[model samples]
Target: MVTVLTSGLASSLMDRLRRAAMKLALGEQPPEDLPMIAALALADGLESPALVELAGLSRRDPPADIRDLFTEALAELGLPMPRVEEAWIDRMLDAARAMLSGSLSPYEASDEIYWCLCHLDRTDRVTEPMLLFAGLWSNWEDWPDGRPTIEQNMREAAADLLRSHGEQVSEHE
Candidate 1:
């Protein structure tokens, strides 16, 4: 009997994912509605780039179709978009000053002040970019509870989420 190694199992799974993605690409049916579908994929822990590519392959545009819904999603979670300019510096500086005087430490204040900048860095003004950006880079020291190498961790999280929802992540190319 031929013993299938772990790599063999992974290879088999990847092949299945490829087949599924190809099927979607060919069928042109796509997943369900846009935001929910994208949200579902996000919940499944799919990275932003993967999600974007998958969406492109599946031909879905949840965010574009429902800007209100996307905005609602972000607002519901109290996530603010970053708007940077010299005009805003005074306000930010004031907040920084207040934080400095208050119990918040410089490190904490700096983090809060740079939070939006970080968001800008992550998203490049794109909705899906932030998640993958954050998820991929979240394991760094600058990020909370970040480990040395957490790409696999992020992928596993995405996979587990998708699996729990009865969704499948196509073995990426």
Candidate 2:
């Protein structure tokens, strides 16, 4: 068996790295490629076992297979490994649905939404529903456990935003 050793970057820490890459990609001057993104993360003083491994790869002679290495790193980091064009939007909607389904905590979802919105590339493509979601759902000062009505309202708003954005809500939802 040919066992592949991963950098073990698949967790919240790596998720933060993914957000950093997204922010950079959305920035005025995006990096040329994924390795540059990783390099910039290293330049930004973001360090981790996995990030360090990627950085080492960046220093290689000829830097052969950087794309492959970068892709592998993302996979190990539980990042947008599939590299689908819609991965970012899909992740946002999926995270929101998980929150509604009780699989993901509201606080985590709120944080993710806040981060996503702050880093989003605001262009003509942005819609009113996206704005509404950012204004309404991203910030929750106090999500009281006893208030089922409040949660329901949040869920409804999220569902509307998801539907407007073309995300299919679960049948049970």
TM-score of each: 0.19, 0.44
When summed lDDT is taken over every stretch of 10 residues in candidate 2, the lowest stretch is: 1-10
Candidate 1 wrong stretches, greater than 4 Å: 1-137, 141-148, 170-173
Tens digits of lDDT, candidate 1, 21-136: 33333333233444344445444433344334333433344534443343333333232322343213322343344343455543443444444234333434323423443545
1-173, model 2: which lDDT tens digit per residue?
A: 11232345334335555654444334422233545567665665444455555666544434345545555555554465433334456566766777778886655664555455544466644445456555545345444554465456557766765786887887556
User: lDDT of each prediction vs. the true structure?
Assistant: 0.38, 0.54
The superposed Cα distance between candidate 2 and the true structure at residue 84, in angstroms, equals 9.7
The TM-score, computed over Cα atoms with residue i paired to residue i, of candidate 2 is 0.44
Index of the highest-lDDT prediction: 2
Model 1 TM-score (2 dp): 0.19
